[model samples]
Target: MTAEEYQEDILDHMEHMEAETMPDVNSIDIQTEIQWFMRPYLLDFLVEAHAAFQLLPETLFLAVNLLDRYCSRRVVYKRHYQLVGCAALLIAAKYGDRKERVPTVRELKSMCCSLYDDEMFTQMEWHVLQTLNWVIGHPTVDSFLQIALSEVTYDAEVEHMAWYISEIALFHKEFVSVRPSVLARSALALARCVLSRSQARQSEWAGTYDPVVVLNLSNHLYQPSQVLSRKYASMHLSAVSTTVEEFLQRQAQIARRNITPPTPPALENQKPDADGYLTPSTPQKSHYDAVMQHGCLTPPITPDNEFGASNFAKNVLPRLYPVTPTSAPQEAPQQQPQQYSYQPYLQPRLAQ
Candidate 1:
């Protein structure tokens, strides 16, 4: 058989391998500290590292696949979370990338701000390989995308747009269970529509994937990684992210235009004068002027309120330009504790 035929046969076989080895759809269910939302932050780290090392696109997806598979089996602590990622990248680089391009453990260590020592990374790498049973030949979404792109007329924009959409899906937990082939096809269709390319070719493509399912999956692309968007904003990628953003913005404007404006109530009295000009009734004070006069609309200030004139004179002014010779310098106010949307990064771990 020819090389293309061999490659196609391998990919066809990978569909089965993916089903057997893919991480659990609700894999984070087993994780105690790692919530679903925090996955994006970790993904952002991986993207930056992937770009910095100049690794192949397939290597990045393979690394994430390994990381998720490893996490699926292991109990990863928060401190060791990023260490797992470093190990996954290292293993993926060794597996897929050339020997010269593979990142050294020291390079990954430095990328991680030296939080993990050389021995720790080595241990983690060995641990990940053992957990995965050395099954690292999983076909990623990018592999499927290549085949789809090849089947149709080639456009650099479509390739970049489809890849950008697929990368965004990596941050989403919902798409984890969906097959990469499905994602690749849906992303290509959406990219074509965004670029206003012909859908004549897609008529054949739709028969394979359900239109409802493809439409639903397409909705998830609305949210993408900001870091990845900026990465694709370069001239090299044809700035497809900006194109998608403009498409969404134009859709929003069209939706706004369709909204019916509220109608004014009909007048009861006949009020037109000699010149036939129906003059508006009485002039009213501008709401903005009223606001300026009233200040910020706080409750009528009592003597104790900080912003009250008397209190400002007595306390605020002195603090602003303190003339105190030495009045036992006032204690600074304690700030309220900040509330974070997600768990904070690793606190210093004690040496074992």
Candidate 2:
């Protein structure tokens, strides 16, 4: 196909896949058998696994999408959560990666410390495929992102930071409700915001943008994502957090000055407190409490292949989803820019 025709075809495919794969947020209830907090923990392990397996970004996104779709339709026990994740990963790899790169049944079992044997994983993989109706090739956020990024002129650092923010969004429940195209746009806008402030002088492409337009478009597209907001506020993980804080400060300033900013549909029910920050609604189980309650607060024991069957019950199951401590020292905020510039891009054309 011609280049223009190829782009149009990709956009058409993205719309179709997004419609098929989008999760129904309203249908998800933390009070059900699976808790809300468990998602983040599960996503954390998926991230680690993706890194360990050196899987593609598209693979990670597809795997998470599959897991969420399955969890939304079924009531999965916490015990089977890891199995579901591994199965999702295996499925995603088969579709998105080379055969040699996909982890074997034994490798996956070893990764879970043999709490589940190869047969169990095999069974679970079939179950996931059945639950998902064999829909393994649907488009993901990364798929939309690749197309969106192609429309913009960005440096490698900007691309990487945008990717980091997008991956972080995968861990947030609120983001699950967002469309893939909107998510990609918001991530790119945030990345540009960070890049604008950090640079001593703006690049040529940066000069062609207007910050107000970018922020407005992003705000209109994405609701206040608490998990994403808090994550970006942390200075330890990325310098982008500092930029986000400064960007928010400027937004608050504009609002105080009586400039009407476009509000997103998701944030209509969310009112900002006196500090102009919106706190997320309480989850059924807080992340920390869930970690403690599930014995996920400590590092997991490495797999011991030589352990006897008698020791299996004590040493294996609990280690499947171990959690690391959460801590990030606060840093002084950066100075706000006198003027910001951002240019909004067009959304992908929808199919008729």
Candidate 3:
């Protein structure tokens, strides 16, 4: 299929997946013991974990998917939340990473501060798989992003910027309810808006695409992802927030001139072939392969000087497990070694 056709096919599949897996907003109450506030922290830790382990982007997405789906079905205690999150990541690694890259039970246990023993983690891993019905192939925002971005200009920087924005979106609870395709498109549109604003001073026609339309679609499709918005505002990783502010200001200036905003292109519906699949064209396949290999079209673009697993473990891990200084170092010893006396790792759950 042509790039456009491939994009359309991916969009169709995303729509179906969204319908099949969308979480029910009404059923989710974050105000109880499980404060909605804790979710962002958990996600932040997961992102750090993803970077720390140098796992594939697909693995991170799958891990997050499992975390959300399992949480939706079960009433997880706040204490057990981190354990569940770690278990999900472990399961995802086994599914998406090569055997050599997958972390061992001991490694994951150490990462979780050894709060839960190996048996606890193993039980939670089995619980997640059972809760998710052993399905781990959901189409993530990253996948849709690759397809959507290929249709637009192929600027490596812009692609990385959109990816950064999308990854930020994953940290917000509101976005969990949004469709992956919509999130990917909105991120791309925002990236384009940012790029256009930067060149507006030199070129009269720099702001070709309409930011109002893109922002409006995003607002209508998903609840306000304030965490994501605030993160962009605070981080120096990119000028996305400033660009967005400038875009709005420019839009207002253009509106005063009575310039009609261009109508955004409607998403086209493309039928699948007799084989029930849309074979991507050479260029499309190449772009897809690049994303699979490199996670994005470009190399890592995080602004932090040392953005890796070690940095994450050293900096972010402490925040999650605050260290209290004791008079004697021996007074507060590290986690006790596991006895492994609990039931077998894969004990079957009792039927309801």
Candidate 4:
């Protein structure tokens, strides 16, 4: 069997494995102490951490895969949530990356502001490996995307937009149980619609997706993760993030036009009531909107930052995490171990 001929078999096997290893998003309801709202904070932290190491994009996806699968199966303490993320990242890096690029125990500890020790990482890693029965080879969404992308004419905007949309899914629970193949296809489809490439060659590679699911994802994107947007907005990415924002803005305008509310007759045209005060015209636009209409909605372009990921360590790290070290008995630095629901860490952190 030639490699090309065997491709179908390979994909079929991966889909089967995905069904087995996929995390149950509903598994969060089983936990007593944690809620769904806490996930985005940890995921944001993971995104920044992933960028700092400059690891492969697939490494980040696999790490998230491990985190979700382990959390679904184990009764994790709130304190251990962040630790689990760190271990997942470590396992992913070691599994797929060059040894030199893998983060060290000390580096991981520092990243956590010294909240966890080497032993904790080791134990958690072993626990994760055991819970999943050492099944770390499940194909990630990125893999499925590569298969689809290979079938299509390459467009960097489409590629980056697809990735940007996929990363946005990581922060939301709605996407947790979505099949990797489905998510990849849906993201590609949505990317095509957003980039206005739908009439071009999209039908060749986008395949087909659930319209309801695709629309749901599209509506949910009115607000997107600023961090992921920045990651893909770099000069090399063709600033696909900006491309998406503009596309969505146009969509919003079209939606408004289609729904065109009764243009309230001009104030002068309306007959005044017996009470005498002129009735207010259609709900007046908010002052905020008035100001935004005058060129403030879109940020001015700056010299294109080559890769926003690199800025996470130097610029964003300090703002996002103000390390408050606890006093150690020995000569170590103080570490403020944040609770699992660390609200301070919730602010969107990423590059431009």
On residues 264-285, what C-alpha lDDT tens digit does candidate 1 reach at each position?
9998864444334333465633
Which one is best on lDDT? 4
* 8 Cα displacement, candidate 1 (Å): 6.0
Candidate 4 Cα lDDT to native = 0.78
Model 3: CA > 4 A from native = 1-10, 30-32, 197-352
**Candidate 2 — what's its lDDT?**
0.68
Candidate 1: global Cα-lDDT? Answer: 0.77
Model 4 segments beyond 4 Å from truth? 199-206, 261-352
Worst 10 residues of 3 by lDDT: 285-294
Per-residue lDDT over 235-263 for candidate 3, one digit per residue giving the tens place of the 0 to 100 score: 44454555455766676788777876667
TM-score ranking, high to low: 4, 1, 2, 3
TM-scores, one per candidate: 0.71, 0.58, 0.56, 0.71
Answer with 1 or 2, whichever has the higher TM-score: 1
Scored against the true structure, residue 105 in model 4 reaches a CA lDDT of 82
